[model samples]
Target: MDTSSIVILDFGSQYTQLIARRIREQNVFSVVLPCTAKIDEIQAQNPLAIILSGGPCSVYDADAPPADPEVLNLGLPVLGICYGLQFITHHLGGKVSPAPRREYGHAEVELIDRANPLFSEIPANIHVWMSHGDEALELPPGFHLTAKTANAVAGIANPERRIWAVQFHPEVHHTKQGSALLRNFLFSIVGAKPDWTPGHFIQSTVTAIRKKVGSGHAICALSGGVDSSVAAVLVNQAIGGQLTCVFVNNGVLRRDEFQKVQRNMRDNLGLNLVAVDASERFLAKLAGVTDPETKRKIIGNEFIAVFDDEAHRIAKQTGGVDWLVQGTLYPDVIESSSVKGPSQTIKSHHNVGGLPETMKLKLIEPLRDLFKDEVRRIGRDLHMPDDILQRQPFPGPGLAVRILGEVTPERVALLQEADDIVVAEIKAAGLYQQIWQSFAVLLPVKSVGVMGDQRTYAYTCAIRAVHSEDGMTADWVPLPYEVLKTISSRIVNEVRGINRVVYDITSKPPGTIEWE
Candidate 1:
């Protein structure tokens, strides 16, 4: 065993990654492996404990994913959650049956064994999130029921065998005792220590980069947003003067984004930054290209070409650098996993991916595994400015996505003006921090209206604001009616764009906040 790590086996559950997050919160490192992982691979990882994640499928289903029997026989502490509990019980000669009434929400759990390590410090009856359709009728030999709910057994433990199982989800906030229960299992029952932290991560990455680069230089594509800026700072800290940052202004950014970004790069972070004005090139290429997907593809391709040309120029001038750095995050990696599948072909991601293999430079991505909130925390720890760290997320494709149909210099200017008004009004109302994402969308259709006794016809605008912990799921924020009225009136009167304005009220399941 590595004596420092845990392995979470994913069974295609939405909360599988949450299990790993919870483990990391305890300071113990964790990795998610496919449930069909080989016995040899599991052994090679030498995990201190193995956690099986819940899945959508019932254990009795014909094609349900199963765990390797060799994993159970390795004498390591094992914890099974939700469907995982059913799988363990069924594999060990126990009985499982579909529930007559499936439990799907909050439930009260009572711990029968007060002395049990997993329930020692917790209360007797605690709230837990339960989502399951199957229940275990009986436990395997040597295992005894440790906890129960009003309807069925809630948990089981075999102390001698170092195995435990729970039918409830302990990784969600809806379960008040979830964190405590997981801490007990990871620390008390399995004897794992918490050592994962940003410091450890920074040191490890520095060591890895040193070994990989061996005094070579690298270049960064800084977009002035949180992601690329933070990435540049991290790489600069690691490699010192060997890293150069290149910031491009494609003429589609928000009001004054370019200037503020330059000040940030030069003054605060003290990076060797190159400011390239490619607005003319981008505007030329985007002329008459109205399709959203087409705009994204052209922008992505142009961004690569620009960066490549700059990198080659710098390399030629500075003895030939050997690496490229980017600010790709964990969610970006997860969503882009199926690049060759139908999903990738249909969806348009603003970030640039699929870098050329023909380029001689190797790649360095330090923030690949971090969530957005975690990235913000790292930036704070590094003493980055609050304005840059808390800045709203803007798509790499910029105002192009905000414009529904056509791409033109005039249209870009109009959208930028309207977007500026939205940002300014939201900030004045002190609601910027409360909202996860807020932006203005420009519509191609125009409405007729009169301003100061003059007839005017311009593009319509839509206000989109959403609240989310993670971008994966979100709910539209319900701004005060007065605030909405104020914003709508100001945009129509101040900006010369559109006549009509509307607010998007759709939730994430039915609608994504982004119009494109």
Candidate 2:
């Protein structure tokens, strides 16, 4: 079945991606486009509905981005969010001005007209997350006030025109009935079908891979993480013997990761696998590269070089390979490309845009359109081991970025030991599954500490543990004091390089999950 979709017009809002994720949660595909996207670009998705995302800018600003006025005439259900509501009011001959009292957090909206389809089954009084300074003082000609809060008009709607606007963020988790409100708009207003599923994705993806590969030899860059492993398994299932998997040990892996992954691929996955120990080559190029982007680029280029060499060797052994498989995910693509509005390049993902331009093999990314959780579901459907499916996300550059300075064999060894302790302690505390990513970073600076009666100086290690639904946003995990103590003590006492241990308490907005 063709997946029904919704189009989310991003107005440079931080929560725009969350809006897309929420719609996808309802089993309807959602694509994000810039608010300035042309009318033709908006219609190309054949979306059942269009949603305007909230933004930081006001509608009255001289440089404020505007959607094509023709979008409202598209005859599709349209739901405008915070800034979206202000845009609708300002553009449709309604009055919009700065609210008498700005609403920045949670607020309650009383339904003034609950009969509207947008609030079909929602309660009369709903708590919502509000983050806006502008207020829609008057409704457009055909619109009526459907909801209101103490500070401003909460919502306005025109059932006949299938248009609705809300002055609060329904995409964030703070909004109590946000999901239900979105469901009403998606199913009741837009009449979209919920047909997207992991099972359906697996069947369709396998079929697609077979049709594209068509008995051609394919080489998969296996990182031993869930994404790449799942991609490798899916491709192997599609074209059994035509697939050859290459596992590169870049010398930046976690403690004992290379051997564990190599054994698992050989004994458990049972795929035709080859392990390349190019740690020295990678470490050599990464030497004295302190800049994070430069390190990422170096690692990326070296990876492609290793893969190219392997591809040539494999070709001589078994004809020629035509495809290079990667486990690139949706966030990687979105972050790497300006696909959804004017997005900042957060970081360059190793698998997404990191491939060298000179590569000759055709690319096959089976999991490119999927999120991490969705990829996990596909892995489970493929009967992958629970450990592999639930493993925490690791960067392709491995500990190179985590070291936060020049790469060296000694620093890599120190980090590996400290990182292993973190995992061991977290697993022992039974908090491994609850945490999204938990690891230890080896900071370059050394701190003084007392060992018995003697003073010692060693590298300081920082521990980071975060809780997140998706990797896009995260909160630092409030770990039990005892767990923290255990990890700190273990790292300082057992590991040779870490004298002091500190926890990262910052969240995603001001601080990224990684120190680098």
Best by lDDT: 2
lDDT of 2 by residue, 469-498 (tens): 777789999999999999999999999867
Number of clashes recorded per candidate:
2, 0
The local distance difference test score of model 2 is 0.87
Residue 171 miss distance in model 1 (angstroms): 0.6
* lDDT to native, each model: 0.83, 0.87
Q: Estimate each model's TM-score.
A: 0.93, 0.90
Model 1 lDDT tens row, 325-347 = 88988756644431122342444
Which stretches of model 2 miss by more than 4 angstroms?
Answer: 288-294, 336-348, 404-406, 446-458, 469-474, 497-511
RMSD of each candidate relative to the true structure: 2.5, 2.9
> Which numbered prediction scores highest in TM-score against the true structure?
1
Off by over 4 Å in 1: 1-3, 43-46, 333-346
